[model samples]
Target: MASSQRSRSSTLFCAFLTLLNDRLSESLIFPLLPFLLASFSNDGRIIGLLAGSYALAQFGFTPLIGALSDHYGRKPVIAGCVAGSVLGLGLFALTLSIDWASVAWVSGSSLPLGLLFLGRLIDGVSGGTAATASAVLADITPPERRAKAFGLIGVAFGLGFILGPAMGGLLGRINVMLPLLIAVAIAVLNLLLVVGVLPETHPPQARLPLPRKRDLQPFSPLARVLRDPRVRRLCSAFFLFFLGFSGFTAVLVLYFKQAFDWGPGLAGAAFLVVGVVATVVQGGLIGPLVKRLGEWRLSLAGLGFVIAGCLLIAVAAPATAKVLVFSGVALLALGTGLVTPCLRALVSRRLNDAGQGAALGSLQGLQSLAGFIGPPLAGLVYETISWKSPFWLGITLMAGVVLLVAGGLPGQAGPRAEVT
Candidate 1:
């Protein structure tokens, strides 16, 4: 029994590091995008394209990665993806090392920019790190404990998001390539860890290989999974929840900059507060909260907090109240911390072991989809309406998400909750 527990602990630690490495790759590069692109083109539109490409690639590839993990095994897929991440980051760093404009033969900013897109695409496709890590957690943990377990992902996510930019901002001062180099080193470490230390949680007895090549098609797998009525409803709430959350965050920095005249230093600091609150809540508080409130009630309660937080931010924009902005963002962080893990737990609790990777992969896919669409749509409204428009839009969308989660969930909760 002691050995079993130790193994689980070891697996969880490895999974945590894997997820942290995945998240840091993106977040570490996020703030540096403008600086990285400034040499080629300072067009604001180019930044959006560069940023959006990552989500687009993740949307298309993560489900495939998840299914592959189910078939081949978690360790290999994770290692390969992490290797891909290292390659991606290394390529980006290499591009930054050379001055693209001086090389005459490199026509129309094709080489550097093309490689940048390729790198993000590779990393984004490799974004299955979180989905597969969740699968490994499911493989080991009991259902009752899974929600609390998923809090590890949130903690890793918060830490990576906060620490990445902090490191980027500081390292970028010495050299632009420093953070990318750091990310490369981290990815290499993850690859080595997965290859050497992480055990195969999904043994041969548990493996489910897809019979046909078409089974690997990302959307088809998604369609097949969501065909389950109960899973479909839960997934809807998940999608809507993220749609609003991503929508607001997509425009958040713009709101901070245009509305409040804040620089990246102040804006990044604001995110730091958000990360701290999220880490504390998801890390320290979720286990007990999930135990007492249960996943259902906890998810709804978290949604309530998110709604209130969005309202505060919307109000803050017009009032120019720095205190309110900080307060609102902190609330957003807290609510997100609660909602993310709980909702994930709820979906996880519904699915059996065999489908964990596929379903969770689908969840990750929806998240990437929401991320891809939310920004452009929110940006459009922000352009047409006002700086505060994304918040208002988010608040409206989030209200609907709350209803979906609250109303739809109870009916779908089967007497014993079996696969349909």
Candidate 2:
């Protein structure tokens, strides 16, 4: 019994590390994306598409990977996926190093560009590590203790999320690709850590049968979740919130770089501010705020702040207006921080015990789907429509979320979660 407990503890540590790596890799690359894609093409459309590819791939593959892990067990699935991430990040770094201009049969930047997209796609394909890590936690933890265990996952994620952009922005000064290489190293380290230390928490005898055909589809469960009238409206609010958030953020760095001539350091600082605010709000302030304000009112306030932030950023200029953008970012971070957890909790409260899994699962699927679609669409609008258009679009989207959240909510529903 002691040995079994030690094994669970060891595997749980590894799982936490995997989740940290996921957040680190994501946040690290975010600020550097505009600069990275500048090598292939300076076009906003291309930049947006490249940034969106990772999420797009993640959305399509994580469900399948989770199912595979359920059937095959956790350690092998994690090891393989981390290995794939290592390959993908390495490919991207290698492609960046190549001199496509001098190489024969390269046909200009096309080959390099193709390689870059391939790298992101491959990494996205293996983006199941975080999902699998969550499964590991569930396997080792009891129902009563699972919430505390899951909170640890958030801490790991928060640390990585705040640190990644700061590191990328700061380290990027040495070389633009330095953060990318560091991300590659982290992936490799995670792979080694899993292979050497992580145990298979899902025992074979206890494992369920293979996944059904429909179960493998990432968003397949959303259909059933949305059919419930109780959650349907909240579901729409959730999807639109993410769609607007991810859409604008995908192209935000590019916007600042082009608009105000911001460099990696400045852009990274901007992301850092966002990270700090998001962490502070979601990490420390949210529970108290939710207790006092309740989810419905807090969610509406969050949406309002986001809309105002978008307006500020939309009107920001190059010189004195830099403050406006950062201010806007702080507001966005605060609002999103409040909304992310609060809104999800709002969805959860509507569902009974039997429906919890399906409801939460659909919310995640919508978040991923929004990430997949938002960036490219924002980029296209940013290029063709106007530089200020994407923020306006974000404003519109979030406004819709506000209306949806407030539309049918009753006064009695607001304080129910707080009392619980």
Candidate 3:
């Protein structure tokens, strides 16, 4: 039994490393994207479209991937997704190379834009790795320890946010395509780690069969999840929360450029501050807080932090206060760090082992839907109204979400071992 426990611990550690690498690969592009697109057209609308395209593809495919993970297994699905990301990153870098080699060709035609979109679309379609990773955690962890387990994933994200954008920004200063190539390399490394070190957590007896034609409908998993009132309420809250957060993130790099005359490195540095704060909150604070406040209350507190952060950021842009901007981002990160793992723990606690993958997948799908809409809307508002408009909009939507969660969610203390 001691040896078995040691093996499980080792596997979980490997899983954590895999998740960290996966997140790094995903986030490496964000800080560089605004600069990359600006070289093409300097159009915020186009930037928004390119950013949203990834989420649009993710929105369609996340639930499908989640259901597939349930039917097949986590290890294979995760490995496949990482492999896909490697291909997508390679394509993205190739397009950039082509555009640089023949600037006139890029200027004369839409081929570069098409290639960019296609690359992002490919990555987005396989973006279910996070949800699948969560399912693996659920499979391995007991209910009572799940919150802390999820918090560990948040730590991985925090570390990724710190490293990915900062590295991307620093490398982008050298050459824009450097980050893309690096991300591709990281994806390849992640794929190798997943295949070599990660074991299949979901036993064959526990796995679901492949979906039927009707069950495979794009909206079918969503509809099925919505049938449960509790899950539906959580999903609604998740959607609203991300709707605001995603929009803010979508325009953040552009906002930095316009407001402070910053470049990718400065934007990345700001994100690094956020990541540092988030790492502290999610890594150090969540477990004890969940023990005291419960997931629902912690989520409420997180919303409150987010509201303040958004307002501060909106004010900072107009005032050009560097301190206020960083402070606000730190707060935003803190809130998100707390909210994410707690919400996942709450949702996981509400479901049995049988439904973990599907339920979490649906939750992630809602987030992707928010991502799909938020970036485009933010870009439009930024282009037409002001640089600060998206942040203000985020504040308003988050306020509404506060009310939604307060009214709709039940008082669940935390996960219990025998929830089912």
Candidate 4:
């Protein structure tokens, strides 16, 4: 049994590494997105659409992938997704190499732009690996250790953002296509790691039967999830939190560029700051805080911090206050770091092994919905209203999240009682 448990740990570690690589590839594009899109078109709306397109695909497909994972197995789903990512990245690199102006176009964008969108769409569709990974973690971990275990996901994000953006910045200086190619290589490496190191967590006995035609319908899982009051409340709060967070993230690079006249390298450095703060909070502080504060209280406190950070960021543009901006980002990162893992743990605890993948997949689906909506909405606001508008929007949404979480979570138990 001890040896079996050790093997499970090794498998989980491999999953963590795969997640880290995925995040790394994803983050590498964030710092460079504004510049890349600017080369094609100067409109913020177009940029927003490009970003939203990725999330839109993820929002549509992640639940399906998650359900498929539950019906099949973790390893195959993860491997296939990573393989898709590699192809997507390679296609993205190819787009960058093409000269769009040389080709005649009668429509909205050049062929290269269409190819770029296609690549992003492919990547987004396959991005369900994160949800699948979370389900795997849920399968292996008990409720008592879940917050800590889920925090490992945050650790992966932190590490990925820390390294990815910085590397992207440096590589963008050499050539814009270099980062995308590197991301492809990383995806290939991740595929190899999954094939070689990871084992199937979802056994045949544990697998859900293949879905029927109605069950396979696109929105069916979401409808089923919303029907449950507990899940509905949890998912509602999660949606709001993600909406606010996504708005902040979608505009962050643009915010730095507009507010401080920072380039990609400087913008990347700012992301690195966020990653470091998040890493510390999620990797180090979460387990103890969950032990002491309970997921509910911690989630509320996190929302409060996020709200405060948004307010600070909303005002940071007036005076070009670097300290205020960085402080706000740090607070935002810390808050999200605490909230994400705890919320995931809470959601996982609510479900049993059989439904873990679908439940978490639905959770990720909502997050992707937020990602789809938030970036475009924020970009529109930024272009039409003001640079600070998105932050103000974030503040409002996060304030609502605080109320939602406070009222929704159980109030009778203490931290230890609730979690352990």
Which candidate gets the maximum TM-score versus the true structure? 2
Residue-level lDDT tens digits of model 2 in 1-420: 999888878887899889999899988988988898776777778877887898888888877898889889999999999999999999999998777777878855477888889999999999999889999999889999999999877898888878998999999888999999999999999999999999888999977777777778876687777777888888988989999999899889999889889999989998899889988987789989887888888888999999989999999988755789889999999899988988899888887999898789888888988887888889999999998888999999998998888776433354444333
Candidate 4 TM-score versus the reference: 0.83
lDDT of 1 by residue, 163-239 (tens): 97677767766776777889999988888888887899888989987657676656775676678765777788888
Number of backbone collisions per candidate:
0, 0, 0, 0
Pairs of residues at least 3 apart in sequence or in different chains that clash in candidate 1 = none
Rank the models by lDDT, top first: 2, 3, 4, 1
After TM-score superposition, the amount by which residue 86's alpha carbon in candidate 2 deviates from its true location, in angstroms, is 0.8
lDDT of 1: 0.76
In order, what lDDT does every prediction score? Answer: 0.76, 0.87, 0.80, 0.79
**Regions of model 2 farther than 4 Å from truth:** 1-9, 410-420
Writing each residue's lDDT as its tens digit, candidate 4 over 1-420 gives: 998978887888887988898799988887888766665765556667778888998877765787789899998999988888888888887777766666667244667678888998998889888878888898888899998788778778878989988888888778766777788888888888889878888889999977676765556766777666556767788888888788767877777776777777777777778888888887678889988778877887888888888888778754666778778888898889888877777777777898776777677677778888888888898899988888888888888877776665543333343455
Candidate 4 residue pairs in backbone clash: none
Q: Pick the candidate with the highest lDDT.
A: 2
Which lDDT value does model 4 have at 88?
Answer: 83
